[model samples]
Target: MLRNIVLLLLLCLIYSLEASDSDKCVTVNVNNLNDLVLKTFRPKPCMTVNINGSGKMEILSSDKFKTPLSNTPLAQVRITGGTFSIDPNFFKQYRHSLDVVTLENNNIPKLGYHVFQDLILRQLELRSNNILFLSNPFYNCSIYNLDLKHNKIDHLSDITFSYTRLFHVNLANNSISIIEPHSFPDTVITIQLSHNLLSSIGQNIFSNLFNLVLLCLAHNRLEYINFEKSDLGKLEDLDLSFNSINNLNQAGFSSLRNLKRLNLRNNHIKSISATNLQTSKLKILDISFNFFINFPHASLPESLNVIYVFGNPWNCKCLFDIEDSFSGNVVSNTMDCKLSQIVNAPICISYGGLCVDDRNNTLINAFSKEVSLYSNDCRDLLQNVIFDYEH
Candidate 1:
């Protein structure tokens, strides 16, 4: 009876060990699983699954991830809600067709370098985040649009967008102070660098962009713009308003012959030379809120249809000439110097016959009325009278 009882206890212990082994080594057949939501999961070989995020899902399949079983990739992974921290090569083995990628409101500290190097993305939007550095995150991808607005980018290097073929790029409302001249890709057509702390534009800053159409450098601390022999042949509109530009050199705009609209408002320009508006194709010109004491009549091109010259301290001496030149024209009212003069003694509507003060008027009128009397025989008569008086 004692031997039989000891044999029964040994058999029971063997049965318990076999049950534990079978529980630890269960095969997770992933091929039949679709839209899976596991509270906690681990995967073995010969499996295919699709993950969907709900509240909190813990995945402990890091070792089995990114590894093929029998000529078949792992699984399609999709995380919709909740924060996800995916490490490098997380889903590299699977054919990733990341149609829409967004990490909005997810406070990621540092995005790993070369994380999504070989992935094909349709749209990669990381807007409204705490991303400070805007480096080459999409190194070799062909994304349609890249939106990095409302970030804390301080410096942008030239090689930042070197490899990506992005159609639209938005870098608005950042702390970007230094953009190391010509620091954009060749595929960029529309770019917004406004509302930043840029002080000056270096020469040849837009050297490589031959297809750039719209460039907004407004509302910055720019002093002057230096366009150095760039083939901006396709550039049509330019904005350089709300800055401290004193003088525009002739070479600064020699290439913008095709520009239609040019904004130089709210600047410190005293006078503009004839070489400034040499662009014959310019239709609208704004030189308002400036220190121009006179409308640059000598520099005003005949092709201009609209010109804004208000809010300047224009002297009355120069207005008479401009009014006289534009007396009977269809484009005279657009040239305004009303804000220069006081309200009561506003800019003289009519050219009062060549603007000259009373003193200048007296001298010019005296010269005009005085007759030049020619005296051919007066010299001989004066000599004869002198001879009679001496005798």
Candidate 2:
């Protein structure tokens, strides 16, 4: 009976050893994936699995994590420097506990439909890939932050992120030229679409983004904007610089009552209507390097703390009234014109020699002297006529 007990204890020890080996984190190299099924390379329960190398790996349907047989699921899976074409259900076994998945610097050409379905993934980084189109790949996932920067995606269809609760999405440095209306969820806060080929945007493209705060659309080909239809009531910062915009209407900015900073540098704008200065909460306005010949002083709101109007062909006389009507602390134009000189002359001159007269005096001075001489002659003529009538 003692001998039988010894044999049973030895069997228990072997089982415990196998269990311990199955619950440790595993690192799989693509160079050594010699006909081995992916499920046979599972790490211990609730442990991470890091897949490394640059070779291609096909994740078939039969290949899955061994976490389903155990109580704990995989914690995280990070696949770097590989061309992985994974099936939609490849991660079905670790749906409950997988929190983070990063696939950076990969050659993923496409993602299958419902690829991340039923997973509680919090963050997914798929940067620097060759993804051409963005379909509904992340269905039923509550991803908070998604990074898809430096990809080849050119368009985003409607309801692309309708199934997810995404808050921040970075789609910068892509070839995106079109965005279907309501493509983003209403819960999104910050969206970066800079350095793209977007020549124009739809009127109601951002209509549903009620919680959007920061939107970066710089380095694009946009020539005009219609914010009245965008419904960005809560947006604080808007960057539309480095575009081909030549005009701005009052209706385009009437709805942005909460906007603080507006960047319109490096455009072709020659004028800004006074009605566009209705935003009471605007603090900083950058309109540098444009074709503005006049600065609208009376139209500028008193709430503005700083304004950049440098690198434009500005009329020097426009600065006189800008310095007078504005309370000195409100308008801040970063031009080469000195406010002290402007205050003394009380005349307007163009910085680009547009106001220079033949006598080397400013056109403002010549006009002022002409008005003074004409008034004196009229008074002298009236006195002479009164003397003749009395005689």
The numbered model that scores best in lDDT is: 2
Taking the candidates one at a time, how many backbone clashes does each contain?
Answer: 3, 6
Candidate 2 local lDDT, 186-248, one digit each (tens): 878888888899987667888888888888888789986777777788887888877788878
Per-residue lDDT of candidate 1, residues 1-391 (tens digit): 9999999999999999875643342233232112233223453222323333343424322444433232333332322233334455543444254444555543343444545566665556666555677556566766566677776777888767657676556676778889886677776666777667788776677778887766666666787667757667656667676667777763356477676667776667776666767777776776655565566575655676665554454455665556566554332223232222223323222235444322223322322222112123321221110000100
Which pairs of residues collide in model 2?
Answer: 22-44, 23-44, 24-44, 316-349, 317-348, 317-349
> lDDT of candidate 1?
0.55
Clash pairs, model 1 backbone = 30-47, 30-48, 31-48
Candidate 1: stretches off by over 4 Å: 1-96, 105-112, 115-123, 297-303, 316-391
| Candidate 2 positional error at 314, Å | 1.2
Q: Rate the local accuracy (lDDT) of all candidates.
A: 0.55, 0.67
